[model samples]
Target: GYHELRHRRVYDRIWIEYHLIFSDDTSLQTSHDISHRIEDQVDHLFRKDEVIITAHLEPESHEPQFASTRDEHERSPLPSREVGP
Candidate 1:
């Protein structure tokens, strides 16, 4: 039962991101509906067309896992992008 939420304002526009925790057995449809309702409620409460919200649904029983490859990827530098030849 944990959640992380963050919000920021850019030129009078509100941007919000958060994660919603649900039981691992919860159906995808239910989780989607919940996220939709939250988005709607936040939009209505803010009463601003510029308000943007992002909600990530996650399982409450999630097991944190770490892999050496993942750690290496994080530490590795990004590949350079070649522009015009």
Candidate 2:
């Protein structure tokens, strides 16, 4: 599960940032290697030096876990009010 994710494109450059969750028993080196593979996959898609992708590794036990969704804010229970039309 991921708590945060961001994607941005400016001009000819692309940027991606997301958090990756791994089992608590995973070693640091293994996690590092996994992140590298993920990065390589992203690099393959962009195939450009201008593109940057950052993946932060975290244990599955991390607190307050939540999945990133397409319309997260829209799904919130809070209601919007308009005044002074």
Candidate 3:
């Protein structure tokens, strides 16, 4: 079966299939998170000087999205169904 698909180097260091939505705020928001999640995920593939890439995820899909900080970043992993096709 041949069809369009996507590939992304996620912060998790996984080669995930991704769909991109580009925007000014989107980029900014992503960079903001990397500044926070950076420490925890630093040992992964992400380059220390590299910034994060942002996507406009469906609202309420991932909550309490931290633009920065660690203590506040901890909430809960999203339920499987919360992220969908």
Candidate 4:
């Protein structure tokens, strides 16, 4: 799971700060790649007017113990649901 630390509109652009939380079993390379993918997706969605100031990757163990107890549904890599008008 990822936490959004900060987000704001600055002039003609948007700035964001993100904290990427991963399980301790995840590798550094995988975390890095995920962050890059997040950044790229945000960039693509916002075009040139958005900036991801930081994407800090940290292990779930470093967070409060309760955070690690999220339900299986919350831990899914990507959950899908139908979109209705």
Candidate 5:
């Protein structure tokens, strides 16, 4: 399952973040596949060149918490990729 963590505009580009929580039994490959599909959908919904998506994958048992401040969020360790042309 997944949840949209936040969305904000940085300059002229839009940034969207999501938390993709998976059960302990879920495989890494499966998680990557799901995240990619989500990225695709988001790309299709918005102007590809103007949107950036940051997806974080977490184990279901882990506590669901977000950065306490925007500065922290910007420095998050999660991998982020630009998703459009």
Candidate 6:
């Protein structure tokens, strides 16, 4: 069915939500791999232990500052983050 203008917002919201662009395994896999490499270079990079979470889209709670999600496909390959060393 062709899209109608009336349902644009609704459709867009739903499509954005519940979208699993990347599986949990993949996210954790990449996260771990990147972290590993960083740790190899710096002895205690992210060694304090933390839980990383990736939602389908931006968190519905607060504006995303550090974490990223499988939200925007046309933006970047991975869940974009504002993290730094």
Q: Which model is ahead, 2 or 5, in terms of lDDT?
A: 5
Looking at model 3, report the run of 10 residues with the lowest lDDT sum: 76-85
The better candidate by lDDT, 5 or 6, is 5
Residue-wise lDDT of candidate 4 within 1-85, one digit each (tens)? 7665688987768887877788889999998997776666666656658565678888888875537554531442323332222
Best by TM-score: 4
Off by over 4 Å in 2: 1-3, 64-85
lDDT, candidate 1, 1-85, per-residue tens = 2245788988869998877666678899998886776676677666745898888877755623322233433321213332221
List runs of model 1 lying over 4 Å from the truth: 63-85
Candidate 2 residue pairs in backbone clash:
none
Q: What is the alpha-carbon lDDT of model 6 when measured against the actual structure? A: 0.32
- Cα lDDT over the full model 3: 0.32
lDDT of each: 0.62, 0.63, 0.32, 0.68, 0.68, 0.32
Q: Please estimate how well model 4 matches the true structure, expressed as its whole-model Cα lDDT.
A: 0.68
Error of 4 at 85 (Å): 27
TM, every model: 0.67, 0.68, 0.19, 0.73, 0.65, 0.25
Q: Report how far off residue 21 is in candidate 5 (Å).
A: 0.5
What TM-score would candidate 4 get against the native? 0.73
lDDT string, candidate 6, 1-85, tens digits: 0011121123213211122232334455664555443333332333343323222322222333222542433233334454465
Error of 4 at 23 (Å): 0.4
Between candidates 1 and 3, the one scoring higher on TM-score is 1
TM-score of 3: 0.19
- lDDT tens string, model 2, 1-85? 3446788999879998878766678899998886776666666666654778888888767733442332442231112222121
